[model samples]
Target: MKIPIRSECLPYALILSFLSIIFYFLNKYIAILMLILLAFVLFFFRDPERTIPFDEKSFLSPADGKVIDICEIEENEFFKSKAIKVSIFLSLFNIHVNRSPISGKVTYKKYRPGKYLPAFKSHASEINEKNIIGIENEYTKVLVSQITGFVARRIVCWSKIGDTLKQGERFGLIKFGSCTEIIMPIDTEIKVKIGDTVKGGLTVIGVIK
Candidate 1:
């Protein structure tokens, strides 16, 4: 069976595999190291299929990770009002692909270049290099931020403004370890809490109330 890897892995996989072959003739240790790295690259970019729940009233988690923080904050980017922000921290072992939390039209997309800090830090959400995507439907609007961590330097987003997406649809991914935050209206009923493990496109983050 073909491995379910993201298209983004092609470049990395090819480069690493080529280097491994070239170095094998010169140094076995170096070639073995390259092979190990190649395996990790393939593993990290794996995009397994998910069973998306068909629920119009619930919003799914945007990425796979642990919920690090959740708080009410003044959101001026999309909601322009009080919003509840749920932050998820992706470790090296977690899947980095981001998914649409709700079935909606992509209304807003912005990329801000900034510092690469540790994603677990509370302040990292404000200063880290990030891509912000807003999706809205007839019921409500939601914002997902893909933030780059110290080791995660690239944030990939395939979604564009005006694009329509279904709940749990793959929108983009963050290379390596990073952070993802979902900001919803204050009235949203949150379903998960801090330290809760969530799977992208599978775990419900909130319910529209």
Candidate 2:
């Protein structure tokens, strides 16, 4: 199969490859190192297709990574009600592409500036820079947040308020390793737990009741 890379990464890959070529004429060892780095960057932006769940009540994962946290917290920013937050921490090796958890219209979108902490930490959810998206249909409202980790500084989000998104459709990507969170209704059933591995748009994270 062809390498499934994101178009957003082409500029980055090109610049790095050019540098790698120039360095190759000067020092073979340094050029090899640059090539390796280029490979990693290419891998980081890979966007593979996933089979989305068809269940009307199922809420798919918004990102690919290990579940770092699962808890019930007060969501004052958007829902203004209690919600079950599921945080997924993406490692460098995991796909950084983000997808919609369900088919709906984006009702809310916001970007916050803050400190860059390790995403695996619980505190990072509150202090780190992030982008929050709220999607809603006639059925329900769900919120998903894209958080930047210590190594991830750029968060790209294509979703905007009033835009429609299909379940498991690619919406954006975070550069390098980071975290993404899904806030579902507390009454929804939680399928995964802390430390569980999940694939974005593929894993059924919760069920709508």
Candidate 3:
């Protein structure tokens, strides 16, 4: 059977597995603890396939989490206009993999290093370490921000500027709990509200009007 875990997990899995084996020979109880951690590492990195919707006008959620905030904001960084921002807060148990919300060519990419705070805090979005990616289809442009939380320090993005990405394609992941924000045109018809649970690539976040 194919391993459902992301490839980025192999090194951590191998290290934990090796430590568990070595501890087994020296201390049984410690070995058991290592084994438990190994299981958690596997679970945390699991990447199951998702069914992406085919509608061209709807944009999917970029991360699996709960919608924490949705409001109008002036997106001067990319869109440079009034836009709707939807923020998703991912817990430790939520899937960390991030997906593209629409099929488009990567037009912008920027990485900012900053403070680490709890992702649920409103100010965290502005001060936390983050990677910003802008995908533009023929119709509209969408920006995805992967923000690191107190426990999440690593942000991985595989797609780069000028690369073409299909709707719901895997692009990157946060190493632990984090936050993801999607900024769309002001005319976008928001489909999710705050506190709504969402699945990356599976939940329609908004409709392009």
Candidate 4:
């Protein structure tokens, strides 16, 4: 059986290959090292997984990885007040696609250019290059943040200012590996924890309202 790696590094691959040919005439060892690093980058950004199934009751995971944080964090955006935050960290080996956790309309969408930090760090959520999508449901508004990790340089988001989305829909893809955070209202109860492993679209991280 053949396994597939869903990474968008074809451009980098071509660029590296071209540079390798030029560097080969100057130094064979340096050229070989560059080739290896390029290969590692391509493999690290691999994306392999199915889209999370749609279910209103189940709050799906945004990225494929382990749940690192499921606590209350001070929300700065839509819910200017306090909120329960469920954070998922995606390593280089995990799938990089981001999916919607619930069905709702996007009330706010903003991309901030920031420094690239390790996804596992708590402060990285606020300082890393990220895309924030605020959604509103019948109960309350929820915000999903896609934070870029050290190696994951590109953050892709498909949500618009006034678009309606269904639960588990593919709204974005975090290039390479990163972290995803779901912020719920202060009154919302969190279901997952700091060390629990969660699968996107299947795990119930929290309930509505």
| Every model: Cα RMSD to truth | 1.0, 1.0, 1.2, 3.0
Error of model 2, residue 18, in angstroms: 1.3
Error of 1 at 157 (Å): 0.7
Tens digits of per-residue lDDT, candidate 1, 99-168, equal 9999999999999999999999989988999999999999998999999999999999999999999999
**lDDT by residue for model 3 (1-209), tens:** 46488888889889989999999999999999989988988899999987788677988999999999999998897899999999999999999999999999999999999999999999999999999999998899999999999999999999999999999999999997999999999999999999999999999999998
User: What is the Cα-based TM-score of model 2?
Assistant: 0.97
Give the alpha carbon lDDT tens digit for every residue of 80-175 in model 2: 999999999999999999999999999899999988999888899889999999999888889999999999999999878899999998888889
- RMSD over all Cα atoms, model 3: 1.2
Q: How close is candidate 4 to the true structure, as a TM-score?
A: 0.80
Angstrom error of the Cα, residue 161, model 4: value is 1.1
Give all candidates' CA lDDT scores. Answer: 0.95, 0.90, 0.94, 0.79
Error of 1 at 204 (Å): 0.8
Provide backbone clash counts, one per model. Answer: 0, 0, 0, 0
User: Over the full model, what C-alpha lDDT does candidate 1 score relative to the true structure?
Assistant: 0.95
Off by over 4 Å in 4: 1-7, 16-51
- Locate the minimum summed-lDDT window of 10 residues in model 4: 1-10
For model 3, name the residue pairs that clash: none
Cα lDDT of model 3 overall? 0.94
